[model samples]
Target chain A: MDQRKDDANWSPPRQHLEIGDSPADFNTGRVQGRRLTGPQQGFGQLWQKTYKVAIPNRTPEQIIATWKAEYGRFWPSNSRFYAPVTGIKPGEVGLIKSNQGPVPLSTGVLVLYSDDTSFSYMTPEGHPFAGFITFSAYEDEAAGTIAQVQLLIRTNDPLYEAGMIAFGSRAENKMWEHTLRSLADYLGSSAPVDTSIVRVDRKRLWKNFRNIRYNGALPWVRKVRSS
Target chain B: MPESRIAMSVRAPKDTVRVIDIAGELTAFGEGVLTEAYEDADRPGVKSVLLNFEKLDYMNSGGIGLLVTTLIRAQRKGQSLGAYGLSDHYREIFSLTRLDEAIGIYDDEASALATT
Candidate 1:
């Protein structure tokens, strides 16, 4: 009772949003994104995390033809294209770009796997790249501008998995210093890469999501591999 | 760390050339290995340079960018740049970044040198 009275006198932190001030931007998604995996679906419908691939200033149209023409020949065995992506329908590959908040995938080969086995092949380093942002929309739901992009990769991104398991642990240091720098550059982080070795684990990834998820700015993150 | 490292081989007039390989993760020192190999080019008049990556694992973006920078410098001095022995993953990064498109890449060092 005494603690409750003390709490009433104090104001909430400015950085943290209260329930009333919460913006309509937070979202949670799984692999394949909110995209429909098949043509038919109902209450039991399955959705996959979808991402839009974009490169700063490199328009999709200009690079699409050359991408398919040059590297299309190297698509994986089960995959129609080496760069697995999703949009449109099967047997089609093109550069997709939408300014709308509905997706994050832009200009890579959209892969449609017969089974989910592709996850095993995806390297941890192959986390989605390009400049696209993410957002969510569903039946009877209003879409809002996003501050973070939470997602799940369908493939087994080894480093991503290990990094999570080894979060705050020794594996963080095993990475090249340049990776941190590259991410810093990618995220426009002012902090230098290798600022300090992180010591964390599964508990850390879930508990302290605020810091790990885009340094408390953009919530865009692929939370886990399995989820 | 990848269990294996890329092997180095030379195929110019065998008597006139030496090669040092940069394979697996291109660490800070990996960059040095590459620079030294070229700087310490044994034969002053060596006509070709081979960056053999066979059994190679991966090259970080810095390494990729380094390759690009090196390609330009090598060409300026009339030396041909050859990159071979890329794994599927590295090959993807190279192709996606258009590094493969920008530079000449062969499947093997022998092919690279023989052509030169």
Candidate 2:
């Protein structure tokens, strides 16, 4: 078999997530030692979502470079991505403290792959969604540079699936739309973002229904109830 | 670096199994080809679909996502999906992404065909 050097762009095999040096302000407990989960491991219906915006002047490489350098700055105000000290490279873990409805959900993602034009994140256990989200920039003949965020996700558990059906799905769409708009605005573009969402699979994995035990919002909600 | 476009061909070596010989890079660009090849291989009375990745040069996260989608497609059709000829690097990738749980990995064509 021929071995290509592109292997370096992928993260090394890991049994569980490990958070390295990150800021003290970030909540890092939920991700440490938790196993990574993909769409197959999730409990809800599978979804593929894509959001893209055209940037007039930048190249794919330039757009990707800026996207990597300022990854969290493009998020909606309610979401906070705490990038690791090593930046958005392969094998690094990043913490996320974002709001899901009224719940302040804390979770993290593993940087699964990274290169000049693209990077992808795989969610750890207990995240609202289990899947991969890829950010990429590509050159288009007519549109010039296009920056895109594509997600293949399923809700992590029954509770999250209920939340997703209630309001989380719409909020998730708005979140990415806001992120793409923020990125485009920062890169000197006001182009309208294009969004496409597809339900890839309608069946839910009943086996993974137990994943609700690790839901990050549970502890927070319990704390509030006692307070 | 030269551009590497994905190429795929389907063949049924036996009544129960169909093999997709995939070559070149497997990325988003290969989606349509992969889908077409998979459809061709998933004919009636075929119980298993095996992917022959000996000629696969490179694969990214997008390619991995494609595989997941393929697995979903196979499941929906009540057919099993397996793969062989993956390099050590990609084998590890399969483990990391936990795709190995759903798709069987074999060392060669004979081993994959013998089981399925």
Candidate 3:
């Protein structure tokens, strides 16, 4: 499939998110009707993080195919991703129930792009980070085939920004590292995962402080506290 | 399969504006050239860095990510970023990614330059 064709692999423009036939048992409603946000719209300092692991026997296409099919299974134990019935195609919305602090954070991601060797997710307005997370597999000169995840993101709001600066960043890093390790293990490789983080911008967008109003975890935390 | 390649050349249309004429597929493979081109166009006294996408043939999600990074770099330097010559499809891409909010998009180079 040529990526340049009109509406080829890119998700169509959407005004609000809409969930498809996902599991009914999972908690929902935080993502529906929310607008998608990119790193440019986020509040905190921009950062680009990359995590990679080499899988010796698998081809890049084979790795991506498995990753897309078993996307949720590779996540850490605390996270649950409910992919749509149509799988990880462009424009598909996937619901997520993940832990943020002690409370459950219910949000979702839009499949922004997908190809044979790579796929990307864009977060909704209230996701912890506003940006794109791309999972790809490529053939490297030194390593036969490398599976990688790269994120270009910033915290969605001031509170999330503070949380990220405090401890959330470390947890996020560990989560991805665990994911890569799991993927490598699943693919029958013991290669060590390599990680890199770069701060793309130092300044925060103070204007987006109001985004805290849509924080998904805060309401749950407050409700638990008040009860 | 042929390798994807992208090239960017900096042109100073005026003292305050530098335009980057981009060609080829703007993917992760083009990061080095894009960064170098951006730095070259981001010389002192240049307040606006506009991208020319007339010759751009293909772009993937990685390309969109690169654009966002470019936008951040421009914002950090206090320079405005704009783009022109995008096909309707690519323009829609900019909208989908919400990049249209931060970077000005124009139909042609003349219109983009006229604004600056």
Top-lDDT candidate index: 2
Q: After superposition on all CA atoms, what RMSD does each candidate show versus the true structure?
A: 24.2, 2.3, 2.2
Question: TM-score for every candidate vs. truth?
Answer: 0.33, 0.96, 0.95
Off by over 4 Å in 2: A1-4, A220-227, B1-4
Give the higher-DockQ candidate: 1 or 2: 2
The residue-by-residue lDDT of candidate 2 on A131-184, one tens digit each, is 999999887777888999999999999989998999999999999999999999
Q: After superposition, which runs of candidate 1 have C-alpha atoms over 4 Å from their true positions? A: A1-227, B1-18, B27-29
lDDT of 1 at B116: 63
What residue pairs clash in candidate 3, if any at all? none
Candidate achieving the largest DockQ = 3
Give each prediction's DockQ, rounded to 2 decimals. Answer: 0.01, 0.55, 0.59
Each model's C-alpha lDDT? 0.33, 0.91, 0.88
lDDT tens per residue, model 1, A11-129 = 11121111111112322121212211110111111112232222233222323333323333422222222222332222222332212221232222222211110110111112222
- Reference interface contacts recovered per candidate: 0.00, 0.60, 0.66
Error of model 3, residue B58, in angstroms = 0.7
